[model samples]
Target: MTYPPPGSGYPGPQGPYPPAPPPAPPGPGYGSPHGGGKTNGLAIAAFVTGLLGCFGVVGIILGAISLGQIGRTGDRGRGFAVAGIILSCLWIAAGITIGVIAANSDSSGGSGAAPSATRTKPKEVDAQKMKVGDCINDNTTASAPSTAEPVEVESVKIVPCTSPHDGEVMAVFRLSGLTMPPESQLRQRASDGCKIRTRSRISRDPAANSLANSYYYPTDESWRSGDRSVTCVAVAANEGTKLTRPLAR
Candidate 1:
């Protein structure tokens, strides 16, 4: 005799199982529950600005905001937010480095005279080392005086003759005597010498005509240190005007 199936009484086979319940409706995709799988708008903005290397600070801010939003709302573009932040930080660092280098280069100077490149860039020059062709920008508060004086100055900003400048060195000469002279006598000597040297230049160059004579003489302190040179400068005839071209031939 044949054994009967346990679930059925003497059954040879069981009916096919009912079709597996239709795949549970696919659950919302990852990061789409509330976000609907859309990329964050701020993330795109951040990436674009960072890639361009402009508005780096703004890009960093936008990336931070997007990252927070993606975490909370489960939106896409998290990678973009992180990349934007990294790129923005790098750009900011690079910009700072360039600025520092430029500042240091502009502030540095050699001893005797500015480099020949002074025609294209600005450089600092020691007052006693100024040469006849040097063009200087006046940053001091005092108005340009027609007469020369014995004023104490450590250095001056030498600029290109093509650029705006307050004065041009017309002459460089040394005063006589081992001892420092009185302030009035020194001033008078400097004024007269500067005027005599610049007379022909003013008559020849119309630009020089519009300028007045000025000078830089060593102070007693500088004098004792063997500073005997005087730099005769041609300044604007009028207080506010500036020289726009080279006064030298």
Candidate 2:
């Protein structure tokens, strides 16, 4: 093969080649596709709060905000935000339904009559009008009065002893002194005197064994209002039974 002329620049054993271009700059979408965007924090919080069930309204509000942010920012957790909103709505509806049912139940007052087991207010009568051998019914006598506090009598009803009664007035004696004694002393004296009187009346009878003595004394308030009488009563030992006759002779 004849070589090109020496003075004429030409490729012989090696052919002329174009130089390599510099590497292309990294593109905008380079590196990991998942590197930039993150899960919305509010969305995660909303989902957790909804699961807790206590802050349903708050969860709903947070979920709404999270959804808007997620849509604008292209963040993750879209599913989480949606779930939170749904759970919150359901919880709110359930709470309202339960509240309504409770209100209705309370208003209905089940069967429109007071339960027989519950004690109702007894008929009211004047305490001064009470007399010996009279049958009386009182809420205070439904159960044993607490000895720690002065016995309070709201009202009383004088019923016939032949019918069922709570107690019979064994005695209606007035305190001798014009000046009232301290409540503690008065209560003690009244209780002891009434117990003695009741024992004397019932000692000969077999039914006395099934009776318990209880007495009511004037409080400071009542004494100031011109009341000084102490009333004694014998309640049935078996609370379920009612006395058929006057307990005292």
Candidate 3:
């Protein structure tokens, strides 16, 4: 073999390869191994808002927007968006159901019904049949009896005074005439009579301050139906308290 001179054919290794061409600039969809797309921000928001019941509607709208964004931008979190939408839908449905039930209860006079431990239906009775010292539950729609309008007594349940009762009858009196008086005059008379009766029955005590008088009198329709008696009752000043004894003098 002929010997070649050193440094002539293989150039003595003075320069190293050229630094490898700068690593090829990392290709098309590079940095993240999974994909270059980001997780959708609106998708995350929708999920968080859905967990809070009050914002369920808003969450549904946001979840829809997130799905559109993910479809176009190749973003992640489609599962989150779907879950948020489902949760929001269920929340709305529950709210609607509760509202319907509440509306039905109000329409059926359930709001005016007395609280009974036994849940017995109120018994219908003539207004004249209510006597003094009777503990009764008045299931009438009228919150306060008015002389202007005939207050119809729908039903009454006579319960023991010791048990939970609505009101205690203090006095029973007659308006005394074939013709009914004006509503304002009748209301005034009923109010005055109830006040007198309550004062006469209850002595000056702290409980007296918390006692209020209510009266039921004949309306024009009731008067035509042969109802003439006015029933006075002593009730708690605030709701949820029962008159546990006769309030009459």
The lDDT per prediction is: 0.80, 0.74, 0.74
Greater TM-score among 2 and 3 belongs to 2
Give TM-scores for every candidate, taking all chains together and pairing residue i with residue i.
0.50, 0.45, 0.44
Write down the worst ten-residue block by lDDT for model 1.
141-150
Residue 54 accuracy (lDDT) in model 1: 82
lDDT of 3 by residue, 1-249 (tens): 877887557644566545445566755654543667788999988888887868959989999999999888778888889888888888899999999999998667586776555544445566568888777876553323222244567557887776677777778887777888998888788878777766766555347777777788777888898887778877777755666665535
Error of 2 at 119 (Å): 24
Best of the two (2, 3) by lDDT: 2
C-alpha RMSD in Å of predicted model 1 compared with the true structure: 13.0
